[model samples]
Target: MLISAEGRTYRQEAVAAAVIGYRFGASKVRVSIEAWLPDNRRRDVDNLLKAPLDALCHAGIYEDDSQIVELSIRRAGLDKANPRLEITLEAA
Candidate 1:
């Protein structure tokens, strides 16, 4: 998702943070985000899909390789106070 804030458009990585779990369901569904940084260390966003998610996905993504699966990558925006970059795998 693309977001324009303070006269500037910012990108962000979005992920499912908490999957809705049934009281008796065997497994729950969840959304996750994977953000890659220049340092090689990756940032992961999970269990929380928020308004910033799309922005998040747009923020950090850098490279993607498509073959058997589609991949969208970005930088890392793990911190809520401030975000840097983030990536995501699109829903089929």
Candidate 2:
């Protein structure tokens, strides 16, 4: 699939963030994501999953995205000043 310029940038940043003292082996894991939107515009939380997950995998956070046995995502609220995603991974 084609990733837009913004998406690519986001993935790069995500990978950089994941590589900072964060690493996981080939194990089942749970992922939780808290999304803060830049605006209150309508959006689907599910739409926010792929890029970061893919970025983490690219960063070798785990063996693969399939190793994510459990996943959860929620909108923490709007952060007009700084919209972002807070992702956490742990053994399942």
Clashes of each: 25, 0
Cα lDDT of model 2 by residue, 1-92, tens digit:
89899989988887778777457789899999999999978998999998888888888899798899999999999899999999888888
Model 2: per-residue Cα lDDT at residue 1: 87
Q: What's the CA RMSD of model 2 in angstroms?
A: 1.2
Best by TM-score: 2
lDDT per residue (tens digit) for residues 25-71 in model 1: 22221234444334434434342233344433333321211211333
lDDT of 2 at 59: 84
Off by over 4 Å in 2: none
- TM-score for candidate 1, please give it: 0.22
| Model 1: per-residue Cα lDDT at residue 25 | 22
Q: What RMSD, rounded to one decimal, does every model reach?
A: 13.9, 1.2
